[model samples]
Target: MKAILKQHEEHKRELEQLNDHWENSARYLEYTKQELEERLYHAEESAILIKEELDEISIQKEIEIQRLKDEIKDLRQEISFLSSSQVNNHRVKELEDALNKAMREQMEFKEKLRIAKEQSEGGNGEVTEVTTTVRVIVKVRPFLDSDPAGPQCLMCNDTEVQIESKKVGSAKCFMFEKVIGPDDSIDELFMDLESNIVHAANGGNSCILAYGQTGSGKTYTMNGVISRSLNKLKQRFDCESVMISLQIIEIYNEQVKNLLTNDPLSRDWKDILNLSEIQLGNNWVSKAQDLIKKSCHKRQTKSTDSN
Candidate 1:
């Protein structure tokens, strides 16, 4: 009976141990599952935070883009408003209207001149007075020949044109129907420029100009002549006493630009003339003449105070 009681106690102890082992394993598995669930919850929360940050950045970028667009629109509107304003609009209209009127008047004057010429040449009822017309023929050879340069005009070919003056002064004006010379050579056009300088310096103003189509070499001719003339003057005279300051300007898009400087601003070309005339104590017949004179003398022709 003692042995049986001991065996039953041992069996009960083993069964309790098995039950405790199973309970411990199940508790451990439940703990692992809860830990996994907590980790998953934390990962989801992190993803939500990251998405919120990206959304905020995207919103800021969109706001910036909208602001920039508004700024650009405002700037365009302001430009349009300023462009439509008076200074540009009214002045252009006035100039156009004045030009049209001048053209009509010029046509009328030409018709009147034609009528006057016809009336004067036609025989009228008046005391007949005879004026003797002397026809003196003289022959002169041109410095340049026609074959080497160009053909002479048909009208002047039969006539023996005489040299009225060999010494052509700078200020003295002459009219040529057409000038023949090599395309970019100033020496041919103003052959007597150096010879005429002394005469010009004496009392008269020298004016050498060119008028032609844009590509026909107006600018080239004028530039060559002006540059050559100045160079000649500098070589002949003391630079300190007779220097030529050059001011190059351009009228572009109906506005004056100072080519010498970087400023694309319009200057009153009248101011230069006014100051020059004030210094010389002379009244200008016109503003343009004064400007021309001022430019010629602007390089300091003479010192204000001479020792």
Candidate 2:
């Protein structure tokens, strides 16, 4: 009986020891498993965070690419605009060149035509020679007032000279001193010289002058005669085969002034008087001499035919 009880107690102690060891082993295993699960969970969380960061970076890269694309598009538009402008500028230059070429050709054609016409007529060419003559005409002042409504002459105190006469003719000399008076009628003065203007018109030159004091109706008479005569001549003698050259010069003080000077008040005596200094650049007068020659030749031919 004592042996059995001792055996039982030893067995009981062995069983308790085995139970405690088993329990400790199980607890250690559970702790190791929990640590591994915690590590795995933390790794999963880190991976998720990395994925989110990568997604954000990808989005930023896409946005940067889009912005660059927009910049490229704007640059392309600017380049296109500049190219179009360059083309237009080239086209305008071509047009201007064509126009200038056309004008030059036209002028050359006109000169050729004139030369041909002049060559056709020959022999009795004395009538073709351009003759220059100085002429004068005297007429009464139409307006009796000095300043429109004001009556009476300011300087002379005369009650306006009667319309004595008007003469149109060629003079053998340049200067004519007081050949007319205030009381001569136009018909009476023009008796012998009425037909003389016709001869002068055929290629001869004439000058009619009125010289006197400032308020002596010089301006009135000169302007009136010039206006009426020029209008008549332009209308009557402007045929293509006939050419008339008219020059109106004003002599102030001792200097001859050009009627067409750019500066009216330019007081330089040399500039006013020197016809050689006159700049007729690109004007119709550039071909004037040729035109005159052609007209004179035509006139000479016509006169010979008539005779």
Candidate 3:
């Protein structure tokens, strides 16, 4: 019985120690649980804050991406605009150069045309002279205040005329030896006719007769030519041996009269008409100027001139 009591006491003591160790383990487990719970709560709070930060970052990234896209789009538009402007500028420069080239070409053509025209006219004038023996010349009179103007019917160049023929339905251009306009000087006409008069005076039977409509300036031309030619003859000739003469006659209504009153006339009209006895030897050249003036004045007062 004593040995069993001692063994029971030893067992009881061992049980108490085991219970104390169990209690210490329980307390340690409870403290570990509380620390774990606290750590988990802190972890949860940290996760929430991190999630919020991540969400904000995502939103900012999206905003930044959108902003970058907009910037790219604007840059593209600017590039497109610059490209178009460059192309247009190139085209404008090309057009300006083309216009300048065309203008230069046109000027060159005009210069060539002018030169060709001058050469052609000179050639035509020479060729036309060889074509005809009977050369028709024309002179245009100036318009008088009292004269009435017709339609623009007359058309002529320097050496040619396109006049409607007298017969209807005919159109032909008449190439003339010379065409004188109203602007031509009277000295020009006298210069042309003087050669013939001088030829005749040097011993060729040349006669000049001018007849036209009444008051058509024929008398004026003849008078001017005669006066100018006489002056040339006086200057050319030494008057010692070259005796020039003149005879004048007038017939008024078929009544014969003498214009040179200083000389007597024979009764026979036949004698006066005959050129055989006529001599330019000693009659009117000595008293030329006074005789001309007298004769012209008398012709105006009386119907005396027959030739």
The most accurate candidate by TM-score is 3
| Tens-place lDDT digits, model 1, residues 1-307 | 9999999999999999999999999999999999999999998898667556655654554455344334433443444455566457655555555544543443344334333333344423221222322222211222233233221321121222222333553223333433332211244344434434544544445444455433344544555566566555555565455324334455544455554334443556554333322221222123233454444332222333311
Compared with the true structure, what per-residue lDDT tens digits does model 3 show for residues 176-200? 5676444344555554455565665
What would you estimate as the lDDT of candidate 3?
0.56
TM-score of 1: 0.30
The TM-score obtained by model 3 is 0.42
lDDT of 1 at 73: 37
The weakest ten consecutive residues by lDDT in model 2 span 150-159
Model 3 Cα RMSD, Å?
Answer: 50.5
For candidate 2, write residues 81-119 as lDDT tens digits: 656677666655555555445434433443343333333
lDDT of 2: 0.45
- List candidate 1 stretches off by more than 4 Å: 1-178, 182-184, 265-307
Q: List the residue pairs that clash in candidate 3.
A: none
lDDT winner among the candidates? 3
TM-score of every model versus the real structure: 0.30, 0.28, 0.42
Which scores better on lDDT, 1 or 3? 3
Model 3 stretches with alpha carbons more than 4 Å out: 1-139, 150-176, 249-257, 262-268, 274-286, 300-307
Question: Which pairs, if any, clash in model 2?
Answer: 133-205, 135-207, 135-208, 136-208, 164-184, 164-185, 165-185, 165-186, 166-186
